[model samples]
Target: MFKRLILFILLASCFLGHAQTYQVEKGNSKYNAFAFIEAQKIYLKLVEDGYATTEILSKLGDTYYFNDDLKQAQKWYAKLFAHYENQVTPEYFFRYAQSLKAVNKYEESDVYMVKFNTSKGFDARSKMLEEDSNYLQMIDFQSGRFEIANAKEINSSKADFGPAFYASNNQVVYATARESGSVLRERHTWNNQPFLQLYTADADENGVLGNPKPMSNLINTKYHESTPVFTNDGRTMYFTRNNYDNGVYLQDKTGTNKLKIFRSYKNKGKWSKPEQLPFNSDEYSVAHPTLSPDGKKLYFSSDMPGSIGYDLENEFTRSDIWVVDILADGAFGAPRNLKDINTPGRETFPFISKTNTLYFSSSGHQGLGGLDVFTSSISPSGSMGKVVNIGKPINTTYDDFGFIINDDTQTGYFSSNRPGGAGDDDIYTFLQLEDLREECEVHVVGNVTDHKTGDPIKDATLVLFDMNNNKIDQQITGDNATYTFRLDCDQSYILRVVKEDYTSNEEVITTPTSSGLMRTSLEIEINRIPVADCDDIGPLLDIQHIYFDFDKFNIRTDAGYALLKIKAFMELYPQVSIEIRSHTDSRAPDQYNELLSEKRAQSTRDWLISKGIDASRLTAKGFGERRLLNTCANGVACSSDEHQLNRRSEFIVSGFGEFKDCD
Candidate 1:
C-alpha cells in the first residue's frame, strides 16, 4: 500500500450475468473508490449466496491480498486456482506465491513460482528467481557489516516511510499516515489508513532522531502529501500531492484523484504556498521526486502510458522512472522514461547520492521478494550503469524501499517490514563501520568437491541450515567451485550439499561469538551414492532427512527436494518394499504427538505416491514420543536442536518380495 499513486480501476459490469449482478456492480464502484472494506463485505455476501462467478472470485482474492490478509488471500486464491486453472493470469500466480510465502508454505509457493517464470520468462521477476535459486539461504546466513536499529525517537505506531536528509542540516523529512492533531479524517479506502503527510525531525551527533513535528500548513493539506525533496541551496522544495487546486479537486472519469509534483519556495525563514508543476495532469500520476546533484535534472515516477518496454496486454501495469531536464531559466523540459533502470514492474522512490549513484526500489528486478532496493551508477551524461540489488540483512522477503544515504556523516536510513519493527513500516538507521573491515566480518568460505576424486564440483547446491534444522541460506557453486557467506555469530550451522546423482552431505560448523569478521574456511566433501546402496535402503542410501516447520506436518521446500531422492531410490530397486515411519519430539502430550506423527506419516506417503510410487509399495506408521534419539525426555530441558533430532521420518526396507505386498 505504500507509494501506490495509481488508483485507477474500471468496472466490469459487462461480464455479470447472475441475479446478484447489481450488488456486484455496487461492489465494483466501491472498489474503484478505494473503499476496500465496504467492497469486501458486498463481495463476501455474494459468495455466501452461491455467486462464485470468475469475476467475483477474482475480486475477493484481490481485496484480501491488498488488505494484507495473507491467510485469507491464500484460501480464496487456492479455490480460484482449483476452479479456473486454465484462465489464471501471471499476476494471479505472483500474488498466490506471495500469499503462500506469508503463511510459510515455501515449497508450495515454489510450485507456483515455476509456472509464473515459465509464462513471464522475459520479465525481471522471472530472471531474478532464475539467477539465484538459493537466495533464501544467502539472506538468512548473513552477518551484516553495519549495525541496524529502529529509529525509535522519530517513529509513530503508524505507516512511516520515505526518509530524506535535509540539505546540509541534521533534520530529516519523511511521510507518515499517522493522524495529525487537526480534525481532517479522510481515510484511504484501499487501506483504512489516514492520508499521508510530511513530518520532519532532527538527528543529533549520535544519529538518534527525535522531536518530530508536522511541516508548514501551507505544504500539508487535506489530501495526501509525501516524498519531499529540497534543492542544493535549500531555497526551493519539491513534493507530491493530490490534484487539488484552490478549493476544487480534479479527478479522472473513475473519480480517482491523480498525484502531481508541486514546488514550494522558502523566503525569509517561511515556506510559501505550493504551486502545481506544469507537467502534471488529471489523467495519470507523476510523483516521488528527486533532484540530480547538479540540480540540472529532476527525476520522478509516472504511469502516463507509452512507457518504455511496457505492454498493455500483459495485465501487470507498473510505473517507470521518468526524468526531465530542469533548465537554468527555471523551466522544465519533456519527460523521458529511464529505460536503463526502469522495468515493466513498479520502480519508484528515486534518490541520488553524493557520489552520483542512483538508488531506488523496484518489484520487477530480481530480488529476495517484494520491493527491493537497488543501486546504479549515474554517469556524467545522465546514463545509468548496471543495476544490482543491495542484498539482505537490509533486504528481505517483504517490502524494503525508500532508501537514502548521507555521505557527510556516512550514516543513512531506509524503510522495511522485515521481522521485528516498531510499526507496519519502520525507518532503520545504518552507520558505515569504516573501522571494521568489510572482509573481516564473520563469514564462511567453502569449496564443493567430489569426495572420491578430489575434483572441484561446479553447480553444486549448498544450503546452510540453522541448529534447529531450518534452512537459512543457499548458494550454487560457480565454475571456480567456490561459495562464500556472511554468517551470524555465536550460532551453529549445518552445511547441506546436494548435486545431481550424488549422495547429499551435511557438515556441522559452529562460529564463536568473539570471532572477528574473518573467513572460516571449510571443505565440503560429497561422494556419489551408488545404486547398489538402494538395495538395503535402511538409512544406507544417504537420503537427506525430511524436515518440517515447528509443530507442522507439511513438507518444506528442502524436504520436498529430499523426498524426490527417496522416490528415485525406490525406482532403482523396485523389488524392495519399504515401510514409512514417522516420529515426533516430546513436546506435546502423548495423544497429540501420536496423532501428529500419524498425520506426518500419511503425508510422507501421499507425497511419494504423487511422485509415481505405487501406494502398495509403502506402509505408513507413527512412533510418536516413544522414539527418543537424544536424552530430551518429557521432563528434560533441551535446546531446539536436541529436540529436532527426534522429529524425523525414515524409510525402512520391509521385504524383497513386493509382489506379495502388492495391492
Candidate 2:
C-alpha cells in the first residue's frame, strides 16, 4: 500500500555489494530479500550483543520505517541522529523528520526539516515548507470533504489493499496477503506473510464488497501479484507482479527480484498468459498501473533510471508516476516521466478518473504526514495542473494510497494503513461531499441598459466592491453594453454603474457556494439625471426600499447599495443638503421605537459621511410610529408585509438653494 515498500526493495540491492562481518552480513541478506521483519530481529540482536554500528542503526531505523512502525522508527532514528548526525547523510534527516511527524512532534520535525533543506538543495518539499508554514491549517480547511467507512465484509486479518473496479461485472479486484490452503505455500519474509495474490469480490452500487474469492491462477502467481487495472470492456488487464517468466522467477545480477507490469487478455471467460510489458526492465521497478478513461494511456509508479529526485547516494531512492501511450497496434510507447508531478519524495498509486483528474498518493507534496492522497487535473494534451491535497479522513499520519473514484456517483475507495483496521492495510470506501480542487471561482457578467427605453447603454463605467465597500475591480462597458468580473464563490458584492449624464445604479449580488465554474447574469438600468425646480424638496433617488432588520440599525449589504446611490446624487449636486430619515414599525414600545429609529438614522448619516460626503450637507432624524405610510399603526393587527413598509430609510432633498439651475 505504501511506495516505501518498493523503495526499500530497490535499496536492498544497493547494499548487496558491500562487505561486512558475518552477523551484519546475515542481517543484510535478510534485508536484501525484502524481509524487514526478520531483518529487524537480526539487527536488534546485533545491537543487543554490543555491536551497534551506524550501519546497523541505520538499517534498524529503516526496517521499522518501511514496515509503517513509525514509533519504533522514530526511536532508532533518534539514536542514529544523536550519535552520528555529522556522519549520516541528509536522507536520514529527512526520514527522521517524517517519522517525527507521525508522533505529532511537529516542532522537532521542523528542526530536522531545516537540516534536510540545508543539505538537500532544490528539493520541492523543503520549498513547500518554507512557503506554507501553516500548511496544517490549509490541510484542515480541506477536511470533511469526504465521508469514509471501512469495507469490513471483504477484509481479512492480513494485508489487503489496492482495490480496482471491474466495471463490466460490478466486481472489485484487489491484492491480499491472506493464506491459501496449499502445502507448498511460500511466504514473503518482508512481513512474514504469504506472497500477495489477486482476489475478486462482488461490489454493490454503494461499494459494499462481499463474497470474496481468489482470482484465476493465470493472473494470480506464486510470487507477489497486485494493483490490477482494467480497460472499459474488462477484456484487457494490466497488473504488477514479481519478475517471472516461463515458470522461473527472474532477478538482476544483485539477486533482487524487481517488480514489473504485465498485460493479460480474456477470451471466453479465461485469461491468457500475461506478457511482460515492453517497458519493464531487469534493473528497476514498474508497478501500480492505472488506465485512463479512453484506455489510450497507462499510468504507473516506477523507480526506473529516468525518474527524478535522485539523492547523492542513490538514484532509486524515490519513485515517480509515469505515463505510456497505448498504441493502436496493442504495443506501448516510451514511458514519459511526469516532471511536474514528481518531487524529491515518493509519488505512486496514480488513478485517473473519468473527468481527467489524476488522484495519487505522495510524500513529495505538503500533507499532514506520510503518503497523503493528492489530485491534479490532467489536460487533454497530458499537461498537469496544480496539485492539491485531498485532505483528511481520507488521509492520516499513516500511508494512504491506491485511490480510485467514479465522479458521477461521487463515491470511491482508497487504501490506508491507519489504526483500527482488520489488517495491516485496508481498503476504505468514501462518498466525496465536495470537489477535491481548492479554488472555486464565479464569473459575474451583466449588461447596462436605459431604464425608460430598455436600450443598451454603452461607455458606462462599472466598479465592483466587496461587502466591506473596498474597491475590487473596475471596467468600462463596450459598445455591446456588456461587462464581466471574476470573483470568489459564496461572497456578496456590489456592482455600481455610472455615466456622465445618467443617474448611477448599484446592484447587490451573491455568488453560489458550489465548486468549479459558475456564472451570474444581470441587466442593470439607470436613468438620466431628472430636471427639477430650484425649490424642489422631495426624495431624489428612485430606490424601491432600504429595509433594516427587525430592531438593528447597522447597514446591510442591500441597504449599503441604496446608500451608495444617495452618496452619488450628493456628489452630483455639491450644494444640495439632504436628510437621512429612518422609520420603525409599531411592534415595539413608542419610546423604544423612537430611540431605535434615531440610531438607524445616525448610522445612515455616518455611512454617507464615511463615503466622503460633507457632514454639514447631511442630517439624520427618526420617525416613530407617528408617521405611518400604511394603515398598520398601534392597536392594529396586520400582515408582516404591512409592518415591513414602515421599516425603511429615505434620502430627501432638504435644501437646493445654492444650485441656480432650474430646468
Candidate 3:
C-alpha cells in the first residue's frame, strides 16, 4: 500500500488565477491527484524546455523519490540543494540522505543525516537516526534461507502488485493495470494505464503463477481496484476500489474521488456485488485491504482525519494503517489507527500472517530507502511488538512491499520495484529456511528448595537481573516451587531467590551463542543462617570446600556456608580488609573460564556484602582456570573430586592482620 506524495499540489493550487503555461497546469493537475509517474514525464519535459527553476528541480526529485528511482532522485536532489541550500526544507535533507544510502553513499549520507537531525531536533525520524546511528550493521546479515525468483508467467509489462492467496485452491488473486475483456476500457490518468482490476490465476507447486483473468463484471468497474484479501474459511473477500457509482465517479466538493474498502460475499457459486464499507468516506481515501488470520478484524490504509503527518491541505497527507473489528453479525466497527506501527510517514500494504505477524511497508520509519517491508509480532490479545526491518535481499533500497506469507509452508510472495525485477513492480516468491527462523526468546525456568530438608520452598521471591544489576522482573514461586521468566537475547542474567528464614541465593545464567529459543533450568537451594560465635572466627579461618561447577562462578548452597565464616570474621574485625581469589578447572576455554572465575569472585564479594560486610573491606580477582592446587591441570587424569578441588575460592587478609598463604 504505497502512498505517493503530492507535495507540490498545494503549491500548484495557490497559482489558481495566476498566469501559467498549459504544460505546467497539466502537470500540476496530475501531480495534485498523486499521478507521480505521469507527472514525472511532464516535469522532465518542462526541464528540457529550459524551465528548471528551484521548485521544478525539487518536484522532479520528489517524483523520482516517490517512484522508487533512488539514483534519479539523488541526481535532481543534488542539483536542487547545491543551488537552493539555504531555502530548501528539512524533508529534502532527509530524502537526500536516504537516496545516498540507496546508492551506497553511506559516509556522505551521514553528513546530510546529521544536518536533518539538527534541522528537526525533536522529530521521531531524527531521534531514530541518533539512537541507532549504526543501524546498517543490522542489515548486513541476511537470512540465507530464501531462494527468490520472479513469477514471470503471472507478471505483466504494466504495473502488477498486491498478491494474495485465493480460498482453498492453489489459485491467487492480485491487482494489475493490464487491459481486460470487460467493457470498462477506461484508463487511469494517474499512470496513463488501464484502471487496476482484481485478477485470479493458479499458482503451481514451484510458485510459478499462470496467466491471470479478471474477476466477474459485478466486481470490476471503470475505476481503480486492487489489494484483494480473503478469509481463511473462504466465505468473504475484502478489496480496495475507487469510489464510483453506476457510470459516475463519486467525488467530493474538492473534485477528489477517494479510495474505499469494499466487501463481497460468496453465495452458492458466485461472488456478490461488492458493497462499500460503512466507515469509508468521500472526504478521504481508504485502500490496501488485509485481514487478520482469524478474519475477526480488517486492516486497511487511509488518509482520513486524525493523521499525524502534514495535512492534505498543506501538501500530501501521509496515510496510516487502521484496523476495524468484524462484529459477530458481520458488521464493521469504527476504525482505529495502529499507532504502534504508524508514524507521521506513510505506512501501507499491511499483511497479517498466520503467526499473527503484522507485515507492512513504511516510508516514515528509518529504512534502507523507499518503503521497506517490516514485521511486528502481534500477541494473542492484540498487542503489537517492536517493528523490525526484513532486511537486505528481501528489501532493497527500492519500494519493496505487499508481503504475504504462509508460516506452515514457509513460502510467500511480495511485490517490489527492486533491481532485476521482471517489470515495474514484479511478484517474487521466497522460502524460509526452517532452521534459521528460530525464536529470539530466553526462558529461565527453575525451582527453589530448602538446603537442609531438600524440600520445595513455595512462595519464594525470585528476582531477575541483568549484568548491570538492574532488576528486570520479580515473581514468587508457584505452589509447585517453580518460577519462569522470559528474557531478551544476547544478554547475561542473574536469578536470585529469597525465602523467609533463609539466606538469599543467586545463580548466573548466560545465554548461548547458538540460535533459536533457549531455556535454562536451575535448582536453587537457600540455606538457613546459623548464629556465629567469636571462636568460629579463629586466626587461621581456613574456609575450605567453597566449590563451583565446571566453568561456573555462581556460589552454591554448600559453598555459601564456607563463605559465611568469612562474613563472621569480617564482622568481628571491622578494620580488616580481605582479598578474594577465585579459580576454575582447566576444562573450558581459557577466555571463557577466566570470565567465569571473575564472576565467581565477584559473587563471593556480593554475598559478603549481603551479609552486612561493607564492599570497601573486600576485593576480588580471578585466576583464569589456572593455578591448580593438585595435579588437576590440563591433560592430567583426575577424578571428579580432584577436579572440583581445583575450582575453589580462597580468602586472604590484606589489612590489620598478618596473613600466611594456605596450601
lDDT of each: 0.76, 0.83, 0.77
Query: Runs in model 3 with CA error above 4 Å?
Result: 1-26, 35-38, 180-184, 310-314, 435-663
The TM-score that candidate 1 achieves is 0.62
Residue-level lDDT tens digits of model 2 in 149-240: 99888877888999998966389999998875765458887778788999999989787888888999998878999999999999999999
Worst 10 residues of 2 by lDDT: 531-540
Instruction: Give the number of colliding residue pairs in candidate 1.
Output: 9
lDDT of 3 by residue, 140-225 (tens): 54335566778888787777889998866388898888764555477766556678888898888866788688888788887888
Clashes of 2: 0
Among the numbered candidates, top TM-score falls to 2
Clash pairs, model 3 backbone: 1-349
Better of 1 and 2 by TM-score: 2
Q: Evaluate model 1: give its lDDT.
A: 0.76
Best by lDDT: 2
Predicted structure 2, TM vs. truth: 0.63
Native-referenced Cα lDDT, model 2: 0.83
Which consecutive 10 residues in model 3 have the weakest lDDT in total? 529-538
